[model samples]
Target: MIIGICGSPRKQATEYVLEQALATLREKGYETTLWSVHGKWVDYCTHCDYCLTNKECVVQDDLQELYALLTGAQGIIFASPVYNGGVSAQTKAVMDRMRAVVAADKNFFKGKVGMGIVTGGDRNGGQEFALMQIHTFFIINGMIPVGGGFFGANLGATFWSKDTLDGVKLDEEGFRSLKKTTKRFAEYIERYGVKDGGKQS
Candidate 1:
């Protein structure tokens, strides 16, 4: 399944863009799931090393459920609103808590396709930087990161939400980028299949 994760605290522009991407994947005949971090209690990683022994997070929260969904997903699209030149706190928290999965298996996300989307309040509001940070996490986890082809989305989909959901709709370039990125991600998943426990199936 293709999983689209929106890390914005509000169910506005960020979630809307992520939904568009997920819709594109679904239109391509891929089963997709949309997950929002809004109202979800995903705590920051405590660095307690408890996962090293138990292969699970010690903090009791929604991350446990997310872990299962992430592990079973073949494609992951991570969307976040740019905050102070980087990913939002919620997004970072989710990324940090991924350590639990890493502790369980170093290559838990290996061979899965990952794509990033970032919404900014301004045209130059650090969208690229946020996208880079998200892509970096995927790379570090051994996941394959894909982007829209040449001309646009050199990293991934980027939207200038201008602090409003409707503003994102006006950014036609952003919509195109999201569509292309999602298309590429779906194509990759179909071509390579999904890797589970180091085996592609």
Candidate 2:
């Protein structure tokens, strides 16, 4: 199945972006699911070694469920709203926690296709840096990171709150550009998705 992952702290906008990405994937005739990683208080990794023996993390928190979702996804849409010059602490924590999974299964995420999306507060916000942060995680996990066909997939950082995300939009143009990027991402999946490539690396 194709899964969209939202790693943002703002639940509303992240959900909206994730919904659109999932719809794009569904329109391309793929089964889709979305998971938001900001629902609970997820802690950072503590360098604990329990994962080596238990096949699980030492920190008992939300990411345990996220780990399950990761294994089930064939394609992933990873979205984050930029904080400062990169992904938020929430998203980074999830990425750091995932190191345990990489350890448990060295090739756990092999062949997975991943795309990046980010919303910034201003035009010159650190959109590209945030996208690189997400892509770096995907690459370290052995996943292929994808960008848009028409243009790159960096969503102009958003200043619109949940209340203004839809109706009278302030960042609509940027979001529209991001939509094109996400659509291209969906098309890329349709073009080169590997669903039956055997077990993950």
Candidate 3:
């Protein structure tokens, strides 16, 4: 399955952007799942070493369910609204809390395909930097990071949301990036991901 993690705290541009990305994957005959952090109480990871030994997160919260979803997904899309030139705290929390999941099985995400989507209020508002951050995490987690390549989506799907859903919808250039990125994302999954009800090792 292809899973999208929407890190927006509201039902706004970030969610819409991820929705479109997931829709593109669905069109390619891939099952998609979207998880939004809106109004969800996901506590921050304190770098606690409990998981290092226990192999599970000690703090029980909304992120527990996400762990399983993320583990089962063949492809992952991390979409976040730009906050202070970076991903929202919610997104960071989810990323940080994965320490335990990794401790449980070091190769939990090995060979998985991951991508990022960042939405900014203004053009070139640290979107690339935020995308880098997500890609960095994917690399560190042993997942393969894919991008749409040159042209519009040099790093991944980027949108100028102007902090509004309608504003993002009007971003024609952004849609081009989204389309290109999602197309690449789907293609990668088809080539490397599980098939015929078999999982990739």
Candidate 3: tens digits of C-alpha lDDT, residues 38-61:
988799999879999899999999
Which of candidates 2 and 3 reaches a greater TM-score? 3
- As a TM-score, model 2 comes out at 0.84
Clashes of each: 0, 4, 0
Candidate 1 local lDDT, residue 60 = 88
TM-score of each: 0.95, 0.84, 0.95
Lowest lDDT block of 10, candidate 1: 192-201
How high is the CA lDDT of each candidate model?
Answer: 0.87, 0.69, 0.87
RMSD of each: 1.6, 3.0, 1.7
Q: Could you tell me which residue pairs clash in candidate 3?
A: none
Off by over 4 Å in 2: 150-170, 196-201
User: What lDDT tens digits, residue by residue, belong to model 1 across residues 93-123?
Assistant: 9999999988998878888889999999999
lDDT, model 2: 0.69
Mind sharing the TM-score for model 3? 0.95
